[model samples]
Target: MATYQIKLARSDTDAARHFTLELDSRMTVLDALFIIQREHDPSLSFRCSCRVGMCGTCAMRINWMPRLACQTRVETLNADAITIEPLAQLPVAKDLIVDLGPFFEKWKRVRPALHPKDKDSKQLAIVPPDSEFGRQAQVKRDCITCGACYSVCGITGSNSEYLGPAAINRAMLRLLDPRDGNVDDRLAVLNDETGVWRCHTQFNCVAACPKGINLTDSIMKMKRSLLFPKKFHDKQAAT
Candidate 1:
């Protein structure tokens, strides 16, 4: 049996808990955590649902990087000493669990759903599959709203109201959605205080996104289009 350590951090909790697990290298961080909680201490608490990478519930700060514990391998990390904590820039629910309320709230604030685009026509609202904007929207659909971007966002760390990259990305998706009845309406929401203005072009969220989505670039693109419409227009005019 191989021995591995997990360091736990929580909010308002006076002391940190160190858990030691003895198991094979193939065991994941989530596996080690489950065994430690069930066999070692039932009082301990954490959260997970899909053991697969689909559910975003298992995200935690593993070795200071926000990662899905289920997707991370124990053997791949430092076996002797590994720090496990709730995601940063979020309120801690307990050991290894961060509240997702604020994160998801911002997503809703962006109005991520598609709206009716057809006004008077009987024809279906159609967007060509190969359209450049359509492809960008398709990529944004892959976001799981895991709050990983929030954990590393400098804007999120500084401002409680700042909409993180995930929210911005969601808004971008909606803004690009041709079916939406009010593209300008969505832009109004994205132009608010907790909106696009808060981001400082920090690339941490981009680096931390496990899905490899270039979130920062997307956000900056929004900023440019929103803040300086003339710049974009002028460039278009030049062409």
Candidate 2:
């Protein structure tokens, strides 16, 4: 067993609350929070689901880096003291729980769902895995919408209108689809002042994404496509 200090950033208090715990090295930050809430302070609050890191509800700022609490092992951090706080650039609903409203609001703006161009066609639109758009989409499509990228983005911290990383990534996914008919509308949204052009290309979202998605790449592609619509159309036509 190892002894460690857990610091909780409380929204209601000026000083962070501290707790000491004796835990196994393999235990995760989520485990420590469970212990603190169950044994130490029942009032302590946070959000988590699918403890294996899939659901993305466990995302928080751990040791000043945005990450999934369930995926962050105490031993791996190599710090005797662990600082846990709610995600940045969002309203704190409670201890370690931030309102994800802003993240989803932008997500909805990108027209995330697929809109088929040939809805009544009997044949299904097949996307070959080896195709150009398919190859590019495969590498960038694993985002779980954890909001870690949104929280870490500097633009989002300053401008609420900016669509943020996840939304732009989703827009890229939809835009790349060969069958999606909502191109004009989606592109208009992406070209807006608060869209891909707003990204500073800091790569902060890339580093913070637990899924390892290249969010900056998606934003840059959209920017390039906007600047050269003919080139973008030619590439898509060749595929």
What is candidate 1's CA lDDT for residue 140?
63
lDDT per residue for candidate 1 within 17-110, as digits (tens), equals 8777787888788988888878877766788898887778888888988888898888888647888888987888777788899898888777
Query: Can you tell me which runs of candidate 1 are displaced by over 4 Å?
Result: 10-16, 119-126, 227-239
Q: Give lDDT tens digits, candidate 2, residues 7-34.
A: 9998777544999999999999999999
Measured with C-alpha atoms, the lDDT of residue 127 in candidate 2 is 85
- For candidate 2, report its TM-score: 0.93
Question: Can you give the lDDT of residue 100 in candidate 1?
Answer: 94
Error of 2 at 53 (Å): 1.0
Worst window of 10 by summed lDDT in candidate 1: 230-239
What is candidate 1's TM-score against the reference?
0.86
